[model samples]
Target: MKKQDVSKCALLLSLFLAASSSQLVHAEEPVSDTASNLATNVAEKLPSADMNSESSDINVTTNQLDATLAPKAEAITTETSEKASSEASQSDTMAQTPVEGQSLNLRILSTTDLHTNLVNYDYYQDMPSQKLGLAKTAVLIDEARKENSNVVLVDNGDILQGTPVIMAGKYGDHLGLIDLEITFQNGKWSVNKDKSHAQIRKIDTKSELADASIVEIAKEAHDGTVAYVRKQVGTTSAPITSYFALVKDDPSIQIVNNAQRWYAAKELAGTAEANLPLLSAAVPFKAGTRNDPSAYTDIPVGPIAIKNVADLYLYDNVTAILKVNGADLKEWLEMAAGQFNTINPSNKEAQNLVNTEFRTYNFDVIDGVTYEFDVTQANKYDKDGNLVNPNSSRVRNLKYMGKEVTADQEFIVVTNNYRASGNFPGVKNATVNRLLKLENRQAIIDYIVSEKTINPSADNNWYFADTINGLDLRFLSADKAKDLIANSKDIAYVGPSATAGFSDFTFTYMKPDQMTSMTSTGMSQADRQAIHQLAAKVYKETRSSGQMQASLPKTGQKQSTGLAILGMTLVGLVALFKKPRKQN
Candidate 1:
């Protein structure tokens, strides 16, 4: 063999050895740039003279090169296949590993119309009650927080006025006085009068002492009258006054001349400027000097709290979750719109805005939907939330997330138990998914404590649509809401309303162009007329209850002719029965 051929053979052997080592070790690092450059240089250096040499020498060199490289190439192929399979397995394992970040547990809590039952006590019955109060709800809130890491709480207004303590705080000395006059006689205080022998007392219907017995009255004068006065004036702050006078006087009995000042001092006891000493000495009941305290035990005082209106308003409502279809949601919106009266476009002078019976708390303001109330049409529900007119479509163009709401679409509404129990319109058949056992106030407090902070602004997800003829429709709200209305984007302040304590604001209603296209196919004029008549009949039946008479005279007219005849007959009888007087 030639020296050059031998050198080529040695070089090929070294290349084969290197390739074998690389495959055996399964090297993952790529070949260095320097090594790659050296390989390229060696390939270029292969002599051109050798290529033109004898074909036999070229064939022998190629055969020897192929024999050495063939095994290394096969080993490399097997190792690459194994490596690829292992890498794919590792990728699969990595995919199964959980991604690391914060896990979210969001919760929303709401309380509405909590009428001040802070301690679960009924002042009227003068006993402890379990049915209502925020204290009972606090336990549920604590439990909720333990289960949920993230929480948001909100209150739905109407909180400031409910209990007797609240009323007393709001109205101070204006709670007027009770006057009782007694004369000390025969070692006791007795009713003093030159007229009738019966006990004389002047009591007003509003007077807190109207139910007080003679024994209670005598006891009231002996002491500073604090306990009696507090007992008499329970939850209401109505202006009431009473007078009692005594006729006889006795040296053994003590008479309080300035009873008003004495009672005032006692009633003011526990306050900053209370005269405790004077209050203590005001009422000093002696055994015989005053009437027996036990005698008045049977005479029960009228209920201290007025039913529903005053402090008697209880906080028994609970939070609930309602699942309903789009149709039900639309019906509810229509019922809420019933808070307004129907407007006649032809009669612009008619003030057909908010209904007189509409209550602010009863009118629910929902978020996350856009809708408009058509005032030209009658409400589907009456003021009592009864289905008065099924054909009436007051709720128009209801859209969720800018798309028209479909009848088949489902929605969830967070509402009070009263509303969920079918007390309110539109949810009579709704499915109740959940009921939060916590009281609303406590829930709100817990949510705030857990969240640390909250966003107070409304989402503005809904608004009234503009009227068809561009006529502005107005509604009444608190006069103080003028600032809010002026700043509002959807409503404009129109000035004070005819009703006191309320100001009127005009809201945008749906324009004719913006209204949803309602189609009724295969309906002839006769069918439409029949439907109209049916709707009218339903409205009259549900709303009026047949008590309304079409031919009844105006309320201002004379009620009956028989009463006039009876009055004339009585006057003639008196004249005919007149006694003739003789000269004395």
Candidate 2:
């Protein structure tokens, strides 16, 4: 062969090989619509160029290039296919065995402030009110339980002190509390005789009553009184009143007087004492040990049982799992501390150490953390849980699990929905990981029944700091809290409150010696009397005499007319008896 012909063949061979390799690369890759069209055009032109070539040498060079590259192209295609299959098989294996590391699935449920709505029925309206109740929440809890095996339920307190059921249980038959001797006279409810001084009926458990007719009557009266109060207040959220008149006719007024007398008697005798048994029954979960079992000592081996006389709390609040940073947690503690008022030591007047306006439901005594409130400083937040003063810091020495919590550190807060709501200051922005929509009361009940026991010992994670050496702080609570206050630490029973329903107590911050000088300075005798008089005036004004008269028995109408005629005759006799000298 000629040298130039050989060189031409070599160049043709290089061009053919390069074109074939480019086509193979394009075929291997996943092409888009545009790339596929470009590849098709190149494929069509390459075959035409081979057909148009008249040189036999060029055709021979192309044949040699094709033979040499065919095996290499086949090997490349096979390798690409095997690689894809291997990746698909690996992805399938990963889908089958997904277990990675040791991890736990935990759920926490919580409910709060249920107010004794065990059933979804409203006793006051005499109908069903599905808006609030444990019965409806129970269904949500059941659904959650099926999904998770590990679950913990907790209530955030305030389960007691609401609803007609609690009132009925506390006061027994409401009619029995009224002193008048009631009788059905002339087809109407009427007072037959004065029974004001008599203890007409002792308030006891409903179970003890043989004839419950009085209770039924009392329920009706209570419902009527509540409705009347609601109407007068112009809202359905009126606070419950202990005393109100059923009617205002001569006989009905006498009945009201008798009811007041009964109320006074009960107050003097301390009716709250009667409520202890019922309260205990409603909240029966005990946390601490009953009797210590010591094998070495003479003490009997008592069965391990939950028996602590702590205040019975209903389990209506569910448990909640929250992810909170240290800064937010500190902010929450400060908001909780807003419940207490900074005592003014310079002022001699008996000042309330705690803000009476702060609702007890908003007070959160968080467990599993040690913290204190320095009441000397003002709260960072206000009554509405809004940040008002950022400079003030009330929360002091906040620690979780014996370590100081850093701002960046994250911790779990087990709380209820009320606190978790946007209205609750620091908790508003918290990340809620889990919510078990369970009634706290039922959760506690179930825990007791399932665990067969509980240890009701205080975790001692929360307390008020005695930073001020001799600061005199005072708070008013139920009169029945005298004994509890006497036994408690850092607190002393100062004296009885001038207010009828509550008692006053002085709190000593690390200075028990100064407690002697901390006299109970609450509402003064004069102040109390003035308040009572004002309350009486308001009550009389709100409760119209005409409304009471309209409710009076129909049988009393004739008697009332007779009394009016007798008054007119007495006036005439007085006028006739008067001498004519008075005119001169």
Candidate 3:
């Protein structure tokens, strides 16, 4: 063979190999319809080169290349094209909704202030059977998404710590404080000024106050940044700030996740404005409403009548911790701190307790008239904030910037069920007719119980707005407090007749805490000792207001006085203290 012929054959062989390899590379690649069509047109116009004159040496190479590369390219193109088409079909199906002509039936399912209820696991009940775990709630959420076209799940904040999950270490070591990321919707940005505004003072913006808050802010932000970075690279970082951190940007998950959020978040498909509907809790047992706690469709807002609330319980979540108008956030936090100390001072996380949201008990002004609750009898001071008597019933004052308020005025008073059972100061005699409940307390738990997953939110804004300030401390449940009656053994107690008189009297009952309570001021230790002494003093002198032995033999069976008795005859009656105990 000629050297030139061999070289030409080698060159042709190289060109053929290169062309075949290029085709193989594009086998599974997505082809643009326009480019493919143009290529087809150009291929038809190009003159075909015949290989009839090729030497026998090139025949083997051509056959080998065709067998190895041609089939693979055809297979890949068909497979890639099919997968893309299937995905498009699935997307279309998901877009379709049950309601025709309706846009996405976007029911934003939000669980506000769900502090770490990972187990649905009610620690109070102290049983695993009563599990209110988010694991179970996720089931309901899954079913909800099935029913609706677009279901956006949201958590309204306070997600850091609450339940036994705090002790349930992440990876069995560090606190399960997850550090989640923010995913804001388009054209909207969040300015997290929670730390900066917590210390805001309105009267003087230029006050030379020590800027200790800036240092606190830097520390928190720095920690948050580190957490996010560690999570991004899948490093095992300690003390994740919240539960949201665990599942954020998880490539393993094809859905969004945000468990530590407090504010209302809105997500719009296009440039349309988004308005999330506010939640108004409908209660079954409000004052002036037949005193029933099992009625349905009670609280209504606009056209939406809230029904099916039989199993859904109401908590004074809104007004229990902080009021919106009466005071600053600091006041509410302080009050919450008080409540925590009162409830469980020795609690390990007492400093960070979030039992309830504090509410404001603001007064109203109607037609130039201020509506104030009568706290005169409730006040324990002698006009100078001086303690006149320990047992005085101190009412919470209602004033508009230091000015006294009058009745018939309007105000948005914040409170929770523990106080709004119509048994707080100033409003002690008031019914619970003037309060509005926030979201149903049990709905979020239900979601967690039925659905094991949380619908992730895209917003970074969060706040619970504690409302615990200005409200009197309630030592008992609403029923016990409202039904307070004077105990003869209770020096702080007012007689039942006083209550019946509707005068300054209030119903008193034994609180579960065993501490005596009164509509009056709390009793001093000396005063309480005196009351027990008085009970002993009034024993024999206390002629039964009903019937007594005008002239009887001293057959003293041991009485409440614990005196030495002789027989079970006509003696000083023990006022029938033992309420007819059954002879077992």
Q: What is the C-alpha lDDT of each candidate?
A: 0.34, 0.35, 0.22
lDDT of 3 at 476: 12
Cα lDDT for residue 573, candidate 2: 42
Ranking by lDDT: 2, 1, 3
The ten-residue window of minimal lDDT in model 2 covers: 290-299
**Least lDDT summed over 10 consecutive residues: which range in candidate 1?**
241-250
Best by TM-score: 2
Q: What lDDT tens digits, residue by residue, belong to model 1 across residues 1-584?
A: 22222223223323322222111111011111221122123223322211211111000111112221111101111123234334433322222211222111223222322343444433334444543334443333344445442332222211212311111010011111111122223332222222111110111213222212323444434243223223322221221111000101111111111121122222233433231111100111111111111101111223231211111112334445566778878877777776556666665442435554444235554544556666678778876778889889877777765578898676655445666666666577666445544433223222222222222222222334444245555544445545433333345666664333445556554332222111112222233223323323333333322332122111112323442343344335434443343221
The order of the candidates by TM-score, greatest first, is: 2, 1, 3
For model 1, what is the error of residue 507's alpha carbon versus the real structure, in angstroms, after optimal superposition? 4.6
Question: Which candidate would rank higher by lDDT, 1 or 2?
Answer: 2
lDDT of 1 at 123: 38
Per-residue error at 85 for model 1, in Å?
93
What does candidate 2's lDDT look like per residue over 1-584, in tens digits? Answer: 22222223223222332222111000011111221122122223321211211111111111122111111111011123234334333322222211222222223333332243444433333354443344444444444456443333323211112211001111111110111122222332222232211111111222222223334545665456444322210111111111110000011112112222222221222223211110000111111111100100010122211111001232234444456777877887777676666645565545455554454345555543556677667778876787888899988777654568788766555454545555566676666445433333333322233223222222233445566547555655444445544444565676654433345566656432232223212222233223323323333333323321212111112223433443354335434443333110
